[model samples]
Target: MFDSVLVAVFTYNEENKISEVLEKMCKKFKNILVVDNNSQDNTLKRISNYPVKCIHHKYNLGKSNSMKTALDYARINNFEYLAFIDGDGQHSISDLEKICNKILDIKNGLVIGFREDLTNLNLKKRIGTKILNKIFTLLYKKKISDIQCGLRVFNISEKSIKWESSGLQHYFADAEITCNAIKNGCQISQIPIQTITSDKFKGMNILQGLYLLIMIVVWRVF
Candidate 1:
């Protein structure tokens, strides 16, 4: 699977945890790609010695753009699967094997790692996530446990399915991708995953949520 799959880690100022995360990933997968969004810290320097490919953005693009970069790379390189993990040390490396195994089993479905615990998040975030989840279910006709989960595995071989909002700066680009895939007749499934809570996990603000709501409605209608 390592030969056919590419593990992409998206990072932005994860100096404290990038080294350990990259080390763990390198140990498991031979082809690892780190898409860095111009980290202000020593994240790039820290991962410089690792046996992985690094793509540094000239500016600080958002997570969605970073994902598109990795997706394009994986597709061009002819990788059958693309696994995404965050570099903030929240997503567990132990779950990668399970995710990869699930991807192998599903073959062509979008496998998302569902984070079961929302107790660590604030009331606003939890409520917002719940509302967003409902909206996703209504729009995509698929029940998504965690639409914003950063840990996911995608089968890049489905070239016909394209991500509509890949260029969007909104946090809901993950939702957009999932919805697009589902609308394009792709099966979606979720696997329970363990996440390390952090204060840095502040999700979209009220304005962003409102914007995402508009995006969802527009996508639904059209």
Candidate 2:
């Protein structure tokens, strides 16, 4: 096991699934941080029983803000590594064990989890991801299969490497941040990971996906 690592989960009304996610993460990482965006449900109460560090935001601050809070916590606590995962139980916790060693080897790069399956995902999401892969390749000259995957590992000491995006920009923050880190002389690698399709999670609903696409176009143009 590594010396110190913090696993962060961004939650917004994920009461139905947060408990399992937290339990799995706590088993491996020990220090789990939950950044709740004022969830109305018992997500907070359910998570309270676990030894998790809770950062409550009175309003919905978007995913990037949640991530920013996670980074801040990691940096402040002197945690060597920061791992990001979904609070909706889509990512397999066992994958963490398999990739931890590989991540440690990279040392100065971001370790991204590339999901094994995409055929079950929504067609629009698949198309959007394909477009993003093409755009990232053209812009950053890198081949990344799972650019938007939530399961990723990074070293907090490499803060200067990536940009903490804001607003709807968070939808593509994973790609942007990784590219930014690459441009800043940091290496990035992909590791094979398992994925689950859970309808209960409810992230980036159909409407939000459309909105995010519009934002991407606007951002890309100027």
Candidate 3:
């Protein structure tokens, strides 16, 4: 684990996956932060056993808000670098070592993951991702293979990283964050990441996926 790195995770009803994620995370990141979005299950209890710093939310504040909570906590606590991953068992802990090592070198930049494949992605998510990739490449003149990958590392300084989590309606938090970072002269690098697809997904459907796409297009055009 890197003493200079603090890893954060956003969780909601992730009781089944949080333990495994933490076990792996401890291998590369000494400090772990869990921001629970008011899970209705045993997620909080399960994560309580770990040495992680837990931040409980009474309500579901969405991913961007939860992530923002992690960032703010990291900044205030004096963490030099802040990295976050999904709580849905999609990120690989081994890849974190490489990403972190590289990011530490570029103290004031961003390091994001580029997925190797969408083996775990459902039909709607796969289609939406492809469309967003095209749009990002066109608009930003940068080839971003995975605009939604949860694995990313960035500096903790307020001036170095500015997040507008208020734009939660866009549902493209990763893309927007990266776009803003690049626009403000922060260097960005993409490292390859492995995908862990899930067999079951609750509440998310094709319609919600479509809404996300429309929102992204609207946000970009305007």
Best by TM-score: 1
State the weakest 10-residue window (summed lDDT) of model 3: 163-172
Residue-wise C-alpha lDDT for candidate 2, range 144-168, written one tens digit per residue: 7776778888878885445556776
Per-model TM-score, in order, reads 0.92, 0.87, 0.89
lDDT, residue 48, model 1: 98
State the displacement of the C-alpha of residue 87, model 2, in Å, after optimal TM-score superposition: 0.2
Q: In each prediction, how many residue pairs overlap at the backbone (N, C-alpha, C within less than 3 A)?
A: 0, 0, 1
Q: Could you give me the TM-score of model 3 versus the true structure? A: 0.89
Model 1, span 1-222: residue lDDT tens: 368889999888998889989888787888899999999999999989798999999997788888889999998999999989988788888888788888888798788888788787778888888898898788777788987787888888775345555434446777777767776787777899885776575457988887887887776676
Clashing residue pairs in candidate 1, if any?
Answer: none
Residue 37, model 2, lDDT: 82
Best by lDDT: 1
Per-model lDDT = 0.82, 0.75, 0.77
